[model samples]
Target: MKISAAGPDVDMIRVDAERLHNMVSGHAFYSELPKDVRGKIGKRKAPHYLRSQEERNVASSINHDYYNSATMFLSQYVHTLPFALSQLSLTHAGDSGALQLVSMPLQYSMPFMAKAIAGIETLWPDMRLEMPEDVRNLADTWDLLAEQGVKGVGT
Candidate 1:
């Protein structure tokens, strides 16, 4: 729980676990609850527009704090103009940097998978015991994948 930044910035502040815990404890605001009880902020009404400032701020804050914030209805990149212009994602050939219809050699997917495994292990210790046999087997395959040095797969 360390924050290190370089700048002459006067407003720069650092937060540790305890500080954050205090900030968001039982004292924190609840959207459903009245603003007075919830630290006296906004009005007690839903936004007229889906992309309103309040909506955007809440969406961004949730995405920042939570690890798995993906939802079917929401796009985190909706506010970014260039991202929409790029049409989600663009895959280019490695050699000539040519735009390829084929998405080849999914690079570093294994690292992300490993991180997902670690996240699950941390969040739910009994997950392996409760998991289905086939799912467990699939998870076990990661060890073999690591041994083979499949891109970004490592112990």
Candidate 2:
């Protein structure tokens, strides 16, 4: 969602269009596909949003870092059981330790969610949408909570 909102500023549509054309024209793998399929894929264009060249720059650099951090943490800690298990330090061999292990990662999602909400709030006008005042208030509340850190709150 955040990336799509940042697409216009980053020339993502143009890049993706070029990539699609290259897949059909430059790659032998796509050459093996049916002509109609290749043509359909090649002709497809990403939807555009109006923005001046001056306005388009690396406006989403921070979001990119957030995305990379989330991806790396999830891959190593949450997605794979063995990697997750290797990082665990359980003080007790009971349900409390097991629950604590699971909740730690889940609690880490608060900041990511807060960032997503902030991105949505920032992009709402460009999207021709009105974010309710209550949502903004809720996001502020979430941001405050996220700043307090995730330790000693669960399990």
Candidate 3:
């Protein structure tokens, strides 16, 4: 699938969100801390530490905020692939050329296709997207692509 930033013409870029997550999460600075220390420093689910009133002003001074930010940023980037593909499909009106948009969903993957469409709308202001009437069941779509020798995102 073609994707572009800041332009109407779609472009191909090798963006493996999993690899990006691995790179970020596997960093010694982020990963070497003891689990308890990590837990104490950052919320396990929320991606950021809770700052008390006294800490709020100084908290913003920390340089590692982006590290904390990456937790959710990378999570969303990794998890949003299928939804992105679906939205891209809609944007192209299910043009077969967009079929290359592929994603391997994680265990928590649910129907975020609508969020993806909204993201596309926000990202591409003038573009219009619509889901195709002939959209196949998820399994069938994968099977059909597999039969045609199309390697999926993970391969």
Candidate 4:
């Protein structure tokens, strides 16, 4: 992935997977886990372990150092694709052709958005998911219309 800026003041962007892994692994979020349990878990363990174990008990406790190290290594391998897709979506947000392609398929987009929201909730349960009041109003209106057997605008 590459990004170019308009001036000499803007340095070239570079992403080192190893460096990013090391940085993320060093963050307080990953570092604070108990070390003993991390060693027992396999490489294929779920990312929900990224969340603090204090929130919910796993069948076994994680080894903190192993969890952090393994998470760092795994994140290096796993995060690239989703990060690239997110960058692409942001880059294309203002392109009319791209917007039209995404917008023309509202049914598919709606479920995708819902799933993304659910994933966000799973990843950060304490975070609030906010939508504009107008969007909320529109959803309420659509639900009412659906209940009344009137498939009105944009349904």
Candidate 5:
């Protein structure tokens, strides 16, 4: 997914993909791959050495404009470098390498929650799921903050 800002090489990507496919085919699958080339990913489906095909078929089915932008905005930091690197905190300070604890700014949590709330609001319009007043109020506040570009909380 990361195609450095400069640009991505089409041939290199194709080659890399083909190599990866060969590797997976040669040593990854338990038996022959299923005829329906859809999915059954994650490490549980593979041996320890290979990578999991982390996917989201439902997310793929969504309107890309809204879902992708929001996901990409948050995805880079969850476990990725730079963002993860920024979370290091000194839990202990001593000559023998200080113990570090990963800590990130709490501000990131709200936007994800707000987006989730938006999803819930959309899906629960029929009122099958009763949303609490406080949660609704909080979502409203988040929406307002986003609208005003307060803390870059919204789209």
Candidate 6:
């Protein structure tokens, strides 16, 4: 998200948004702003990536649904401390045990990795990048297993 936000896109670096970034990234100065202006800004989601062509194209691609759903799901486990703590109860420590704790985040991160690769391929088509066979095999295995009502963990 930060990568796309910090990209060379003009709209991504809008004056108002840069001002907001400057305000937050420096001293805690939000209170210095007028109450009405602060309220309006606080009520909205900032740095809206949908305004960017790259993000819009990726959002409209084959990975659209999974991208949004997984991002929302994973973002909770990531950014919100209380929600992440609450989800610890859902962690199944099987034979792999505590390693599941580490692996689970990496598993959820796969979609982001895929999105990055897709972006690279889109931006540099001459590079003719290809998904590694093992990655493709795992995706196929996941789809096949999902059809059988299996989550494909440890499979």
Instruction: Judge candidate 6 against the unseen true structure and give its global Cα lDDT, from 0 to 1.
Output: 0.57
Q: Model 4 over residues 30-122: C-alpha lDDT tens digits?
A: 545555334322232425454464333222222334334434534543576674356456656568667654443353234334444555766
Q: Could you tell me how far off, in angstroms, the CA of residue 30 lies in candidate 4 after the best superposition?
A: 31
Model 3, span 70-121: residue lDDT tens: 3443455467766454655465646665443333332122223433444467
Ranking by lDDT: 6, 2, 5, 4, 3, 1
In model 5, the clashing pairs are: none
Highest-lDDT candidate: 6
TM-score of 4: 0.22
Runs in model 5 deviating more than 4 A are 1-83, 91-106, 151-155
Candidate 5, 1-155: lDDT as tens digits: 55554536776877896776567656645355553332433222434323222334133222333344445545666657575345434334553443323222234345445656677667887754665999778866655543333434444
Give the C-alpha lDDT of model 5. 0.49
Model 1: worst 10 consecutive residues (lDDT sum) = 64-73
TM-score of each: 0.25, 0.35, 0.19, 0.22, 0.32, 0.40
Over 32-124, each residue of candidate 1 has an lDDT whose tens digit, in order, gives 554443442232233344354434534433222122222211243445567433644564446343332222222223323544675578789
**Off by more than 4 A, model 1:** 1-108, 126-129, 151-155
Candidate number of the best TM-score: 6
Candidate 2 accuracy as lDDT: 0.56
Question: What is the Cα-based TM-score of model 1?
Answer: 0.25
What local distance difference test score does each model get?
Answer: 0.42, 0.56, 0.43, 0.46, 0.49, 0.57
lDDT of 2 by residue, 1-155 (tens): 24455545478776886786776577767667656655666666322433322233234322334344545667776466676667575444576667776665565566657756677767784664555899767666555544433331242
Question: How well does candidate 2 score on lDDT at residue 107?
Answer: 57
Tell me how many residue pairs clash in candidate 3. 0
